[model samples]
Target chain A: MDTILFLFSLFVLALFLGVELITKVPPTLHTPLMAGANAISGITIVGAILAAGADTSSTLVHALGFIAVTMATLNVVGGYLVTNRMLAMFKRKS
Target chain B: MNITIVNLAYLLAAVLFILGIKGLTRPKTAVRGNMLSATGMLIAVVVTLLDRSILTYDFIVAGLVVGGVIGAVMALKVKMTAMPQMVALLNGSGGGASLGLAAASYLQSLERADFGTGAIAVLAVFFVAVTVIIGAVTLTGSLVAFAKLQEIIPGKPLGFAGMRYLNGVLFLASLAGLAMLIANPGNTPLFWLTVAVAAVLGLTLVLPIGGADMPVVIALLNSYSGIAAAAAGFIMGNTVLIIAGSLVGTSGLILTKIMCVAMNRSLTNVLFGVMGEVG
Candidate 1:
């Protein structure tokens, strides 16, 4: 219950913070911003690792956990690398 | 070993993630922002491993290696023009992970006979159902978005007669399934059925959206994946997952709104206007 309440507060705060953070960004940077945000969503990789590593006797859990870990890792690695690539192009030539 | 220390580390990781996003507001710091967030992820992963003793590390290691290789290759080889589709694909994989995690949790609960009786059980079942529905929808919707963006499918609204009505009906049925699952948390059949229906609903929802709407759709799906992860966090009682999920969810929503503004469309219109058609 306390956790849920805390999480709700966090959600509201993050929403406002996100809006504040991105409002100043130029339209041209939106693509890279979107890409960067996609990488952030890969935070689920943490949850996936927990799932895969959870102590359990069920083979089904193990299988699902393995698959989740793989997919989430892909999201994390691919998302960050791709965002970096896009940002590289966006950087002004020195 | 120490739960308190583990949680404290998670808190630190969450703070780093926030700083990472803050850094992204400027172009100069964006790359560093990405690295900071990745470091946060690394910290979270390592801390989780330290907190738990696994029966086997084989699957986890194998998954990391395989997924890492594929992701690196895709990131390196994909063209800038194709970045949108690649992002969509990555978003879909996140959704896929959520779906798998939610299912695994449900299975674990069943195995352990942990479906406590009464209101608590109902809440547990509700969270699991929400995770599965959103996760499944995100997975398929993202794939459809990718297909449209990639030209694998026509980049136009694809709808038939009564399509909207069919979608409404399926959505209602899924809601009814949720009600049933809550009433009886042990109903595995109902749970799977709801998942199947939700997957179909996801496909139907995105199929009618055109290529021009891919960015918004992808952003929206990214938010769905985050919400799904948050629900999974509730099921697992993990504070970091909750914080990270909310961050992603809120950020994705903001991005979707930005996309809508850039396109000069409202969220409702982007979702329901069925581009390339009059209505």
Candidate 2:
């Protein structure tokens, strides 16, 4: 319970910090930043990889983990590449 | 690697992630910002692999290769006009990944009978159930949003005569499923049933929303995905996941709020207003 509380505290603090940081973004870059931020959401891939490789897990767990990894990879890889693409367009225009 | 070292690496990665987001305040550094975040992700993944708990790599290697290739192809091929659609798709996959992880984690805990005692055990079950619900909702909601944006479905509001009542019922069912899972303690929990209900709920909830409101919907789902990941982090007791997930969670919320302002609608209206009739 203490651990949960600690983690929860971290979650809340990070959330506030995120709001503070993101508000600084100008409206012009909203879409690109949104894409970039979505890519960061792919951080779930960490959980997916851990689940996929757990020694005590069953075949079902492994299978689910496999799919999770694939999905998360798409989020990270597809997300970042496309975000970069969008940002590049902005750069070219400026 | 030592536990301390692994955790330290995770901390460094989290710092990089924060820096990455901070960089987005200006366009001059935005692209580099994304690269920094990606680099942080690479560090996290590589370090996670070195943890001694994993015994084999076949599934990991195969999944990375396949997912990586497909992701690259889609990213490269998609037109800029289709960027929003691509973002929606990728965001959905992130949610799907969280759902899968939560399910797997729940099952693994059951197999090991590792649910601890007292507040910890109760909290564990709570987090797991919430993670599944939120994750499933994000995945399907984003998909429906994607379909609408891509013109795979009509972009206009599409709701049945009794959608409100049905949505109410489904929402209640989701709550009931959650309550049952938390109350039962053990033995064949209704995980899949809960998943199905939430899935349908996502489909129904987003269908009534018009295409013009998609930015709000996508932003909201992106927030959901991040929260799901954070809840999953609770299940695993991983601090890094918790931090990163919450960062995305709130970041997405800000984006949603900004979109709402741009559309001149309150969040509630965007979420549950009377379709084209509301605005």
What is the TM-score of chain A, computed separately for every candidate?
Answer: 0.85, 0.91
Clashing residue pairs found in predicted model 2? none
**Candidate 1 TM-score over all chains jointly:** 0.93
> Model 2: how many Å of interface RMSD?
1.2
Query: What is the alpha-carbon interface RMSD for each candidate?
Result: 1.8, 1.2
- Once fitted onto the true fold, the runs of candidate 2 whose alpha carbons sit more than 4 angstroms away are B187-189, B277-279
Q: What TM-score does each of the candidates earn?
A: 0.93, 0.95
Looking at model 1, give its docking quality level.
medium
Question: What's the CA RMSD of model 1 in angstroms?
Answer: 2.2
How high is the lDDT of residue A28 in model 1? 66
Q: Across residues A18-71, which tens digit of lDDT does each residue of candidate 1 receive?
A: 556555666666777777767777777777777788779888899999998899
User: Mind giving the per-residue lDDT tens digits that candidate 1 earns over B19-65?
Assistant: 87766767778888878877888888888777655556777898889
- For each candidate in the order shown, give its overall lDDT on alpha carbons: 0.81, 0.84
Q: Candidate 1 — which pairs collide?
A: none
Model 2, span A14-90: residue lDDT tens:
88987887776667677777788888888888888888888764889889889998999989999889988988888
Off by over 4 Å in 1: A1-16, A92-94, B272-279
